[model samples]
Structures are given as structure tokens and as C-alpha cells.
Target chain A: MARILAVDDSAAMRQMVGITLTGAGHDVQQAADGAEALEIAERQKFDLVITDVNMPKMDGITLVRELRNRASYRYVPLLVLTTEATLERKQQGKAAGATGWLVKPFNPERLLATIAKVLG
Target chain B: MPSSARPFTGASELAGLAPVAQDASQLPPALPGFESFQRFWDRDNGCWMVKILPGEYYVSRSEEAISTVLGSCISACVRDPTRGIGGMNHFMLPQDATQGPNDWLDPAIGLATRYGSYAMENLINDLLKLGAVRERLEIKLFGGGRILAAMTDVGGRNIEFIRNYMTLEGYRVAAEDLGGTQPRKVVYFPASGRARLRKLRPVENRIISHHEQLYLDSLGKQAAGGEVELFD
Candidate 1:
């Protein structure tokens, strides 16, 4: 089982991601916002970091930049989940060093698939 | 039993509909002039309370006495004493009406700007009609979670419209729970103006996006005056 960190300001979204990942046998930790995710990442080792783009304190793009700056997380798979889906935002994430993107309201299969692809 | 007592026998019936639970007793103290009825469900760290005011309607899988159905849609709990009776509505969209201007067209919308706006107005009118004093009434709003990805803006828009409408109407907003990337299961107790917001975990975004597309397509069909098929 892989260790994953999921970040989003919405409690519901955090619960959903936590449940799905745990059900899939992955050890999952949750953070309320991007800044919190960074704090957790610094203290723990995770196989992947899946975050939402829009958040209160720190956004996903900024989180990606911060994570990439750390040597330990530089090679960790980072995926963004968002509702924007605009090409501009996608490019912004890519430029920030995101490994890939997952659109919001995604299906269970796709979530697992993405995780497998990133961690495998 | 007082006029404000909810008719449900146990919390399990309500719990079957949503995952969250609340203790019945810690609910907000009822407003002085308002009659109150409440039901509670105990869960891990919190409890869910279903409170109803006199002349207000409560609907869902829990009881059949009220026709108000709850869904992952937007609902605005409004109380205007000038109109008297406070009421709430479960609406899916901002201005997109699916059933058309038929018997289902809630007359309250005429008083407010959109569905969310009308819900607040109708609720207040319900309270007023029931003998509530208009100037003394207050409003508490809830619901408007991001149920579908395609309609991400809908929930935000609903919350914004309610805030703006209240501002324009010169009403005080006592409390609010709005805007997030998760679907929420909400319970609004009109009598005490208490609302419980429980977030549902994000399943795959794919399912949510699919549902959003269907809802939007349905809106388009309604606008075109055609029968809207919600899903493929």
C-alpha cells in the first residue's frame, strides 16, 4: 500500500479522498489546505500528493512549487484535481512541476489508475 | 406534545438518508416567539438535529408529513416576519426551471430574484403568514454544495445571490455554510434557525462531472421547452 497525502479545503472532499484511498489499501493522510499539506509532507514520507487547485491559504500550484523545491519530494508524483479544467490552468500546473492532472468529480477507476500510473 | 415537536420516533430513520449525526439537545435555543420540534441522531464526535418550527414543513426520507425533499441541490432557508411563515426549498439550479411555470412554480420567486432568492422570501412569507413579526425576524442560510463539477459555479452563485439578496432586503444573516468542492448533506431547523452541514467525501470526479453535464443538458432542454433526459 502506498502512502498518499490528499489536500483540499472542503471537509467533504477530504473525507471522500481519504475513504477512497484507504479502501484501496493505501495509507492516506488529509490536509485542509495547501499550506497544511506542505507541513505534513515535511514530517512524513508519501508516495503521492493529490491536491485541489483552489484553496483558502495556499493553492495547489504553489504547493507543487514548494514540494519540488525539497530534495526528498522533488521526484514524488504530484497530481492536481480541479474543476477549472481550462488549458491555461493546466499549463500553469505543468509549469509548476505537476506530474499530471485529474479533473474534479472523477470516477473511482480513474483515481486508482492515476495513482497506479504515478506510483508504479 | 408542543406544536414544535418533530413527528419522527427515532433518529435512525433520518440517519438512513444522510451519513452525519447530531445530538438533539445541544441544538440552538429556540427563538422566544417560535414553537420548536426537534429530533437528534448521535454519531462519533457530533450529533444531527432535525428541528422544525410551527407552520414550517419538513420533508425527506424520514417522514411523509412534509413534501419537501432533500437532495444534493441548493436550499435557502428564509424567514421574513412581514410575510409571517418561514419556509425552505430544495432547488437544483439558480434560474433553470425543469417543471416549467406550472402548479410547481413556487409563487415565492416573484418576490425574490432567483430560485435561491425566492426560497428565502417564501420562507419569510410563510413565517409572516403564520403570525411572525416581520421586523423582528432573522435569516440563517444553508445548502449550495458543489454536487457536480460542471455546475461548480452554481453553488457559489447560489450563495452569492443569497448574500446579495439579504443585503438588498435589509435582513441580517445570522449564520452561513457555503462554497466548497464537496457535496454536503444539510439539515435546516427553521424553528431554531440551526443548520447542520456534513461534507460527503469526493468520490471520483468523473462521476460528478458526468452528473453535472447531465444537469446542464437537462437545463438546456427545459429552456427549450422539451422533455429533458437527465442521463445517457
Candidate 2:
């Protein structure tokens, strides 16, 4: 099982991600926003980082770029999950070092399948 | 943002059947950030339609109407009349079999209540980002029925959570049709801030309940079987 970091400004979303990952046998950590996620990542190592865009402080794309700058997370997987689904936004996320993009209202099975492929 | 609750006008006219001529290909594309919703042309309603299911929302700037059916769930219809931008969200508080409805509010255990907040925040934030003014917003609430009779009054708790949320945010509610024994089908026009709600009886309620329960169950971990490749 992978150790994953889940970040979102919405408490409910954080909880949902937490429950889903934990139930899947992965060790999960939570952060309320990108800044907090960045702070936590500095001290701990995780297999994957999933984040939401449009947060109050430091959105997900910025976080992905920042994480890539760190040696430990240079090759770690970073996924963007948000309501924004335009081609332009996906391109922006890809440029920011995100491994993949999943739109909001994600299906749980689909999310796991995607994660499995990335982790492999 | 404070505004007088505008009277619910044009609901009947909006619900009246229109002769639809556009095919699926002719329907306008969904607004940005709402690409996941099922968008179609509703022949019965005579307009472009977007249908949102549990744990989903759709925002529109065009002339499309959003629709959903609720069973022990709630749908919030919010829009900025001046900007002609609005959206609808359907959500339910997570259910814990061991805890009572109000007990889900405990910070450590209240994931349920927080999910409701997440749904509203996302919908409202999307509207604001689309150039909608907060004070000019019109809000309407629907759903929350005692359809899940075997379980705790989750529907009632959902109603309380949203009402308290609106009050805390200083948003005024213009109209609502909440708390009953039957499921409801709601169709809303965000640009016009109009809605048509019809309560369903036994036949549809069973279907709605089954779907909602499946949504809740899917939130838990399941066997991974499908393939979804990552784009790198």
C-alpha cells in the first residue's frame, strides 16, 4: 500500500479522500491547502500527492511545481482533481509537473484504477 | 450579500412543455468546470438540460436548465440574477450507522456535515469566479425528505445543516420546499432564478433511494477492476 497525501480546502473532501485511501489499505495524510501540504511534505515522504485547485493559499498547480523542486519528491506522482476541466487548464497542470488530471465528481473505482497505473 | 427574496415567478412557464428540435449534437457545450455532468436537450421541457446526480453540481452561463432527483438528499439552486450565472448542487451528509444524525457534527466524527459544506462552497465559489456578485445572489433550497425511513432522519439533518450554513454566510434564502415524506424532482434555470419541483410517490422514491444508497456505498473502498491510464 502506498503512503498518500491528500490536500483540499474543503474539510469534507479531505475526509472523503482520507476514508477512501485508508480503506484501500494506503496510509493517508491530510492537509487543508497547498501551503500546509508543502509544509508537511518538507518533513515526510509520501508515494503520491493528490490535490484540488482553487484553494485559498497556494493552489494545486503551484504546489505541484514546488514539490518537483524538492529532491525527495522529484519523481513522485502528483495528481490534480478539480472542477476545472478545460483543455487549457489541463495543459497548464501538465506544464506544472502534474502527472495526471481528474475532474471533480470522480468515480472511486476510476480514481483507484488511475492511481494504480501511476504507481506502477 | 443581502437581497430581498424575489418572488418565485415564471416557474409554471418554465415548466411548460416546449417543442424541442435540437439533437444531442446541437446542444451547447457545458460551461467550463462542468464538463462531467450529463448534458442533453430535454424534449419535454423544450430547453437544453443538464442533469446532476448525488455528489455532483453543474453551473451554467447559457440558456440551459439543470435538473436532479432527490431522496434524503438536498439540492441548492443559487444564481446571480444580474450576471445571469447560476448553478445547482446535489449532496447528502455522510451516514454513520453507529451515530445519530446530530452526532455527525462532532469535529472528529462529523465528516457528514462537512461534506454538505463542501458541496455548497464549490457551487458558490464557481458562481463567484464567473463574475457573479454575492449581494445580487438569489438562493433556493429543495429536497430533504423522510424517504429513508429505516435509518435515522438523515434528510432532516441535511435540511438543518444547509439552513445554518446560509445563515452563517449571511445569504438570504428566497424560497424552499423542504421536509416531506416523498422524493422530489427539481428543474432549475439559473439565469432566470426559477425552479420547478415535483414530489414523487412510491414508484420513483424507491429508485432514487437505491441510487443514493449506491452513491454512498461507492465512497468506501471497492475492488479496483477498471483501467484508467494516467496522462503524463
TM-score of the second chain, each candidate in turn, equals 0.50, 0.80
Q: Give the DockQ (C-alpha) for candidate 1.
A: 0.01
Worst 10 residues of 2 chain B by lDDT: B220-229
Q: In model 1, what lDDT does residue B183 have?
A: 61
Instruction: Tell me what TM-score chain A of model 1 achieves.
Output: 0.97
Candidate 2 residue-wise lDDT at B94: 66
lDDT of 1 by residue, B75-155 (tens): 556554333234455544434444333222222221113333323433443454356655576666655555565634666
lDDT for model 1, on a 0 to 1 scale? 0.57
Give the alpha-carbon lDDT of every model.
0.57, 0.77
| lDDT tens digits, residue span B1-232, model 2 | 2223532224323675333346778767678667767777665566788888987888999888999999889999999998998999998876653333324454323545545665787798798778887678799999989886675787898898888777755789999999989999999988788898988886787788899998777643211111232564
lDDT of 1 by residue, A33-73 (tens): 79999999999989999997776578899999999999999
Listed in order, each prediction's TM-score against the native is 0.41, 0.60
True contacts kept of 2: 0.15
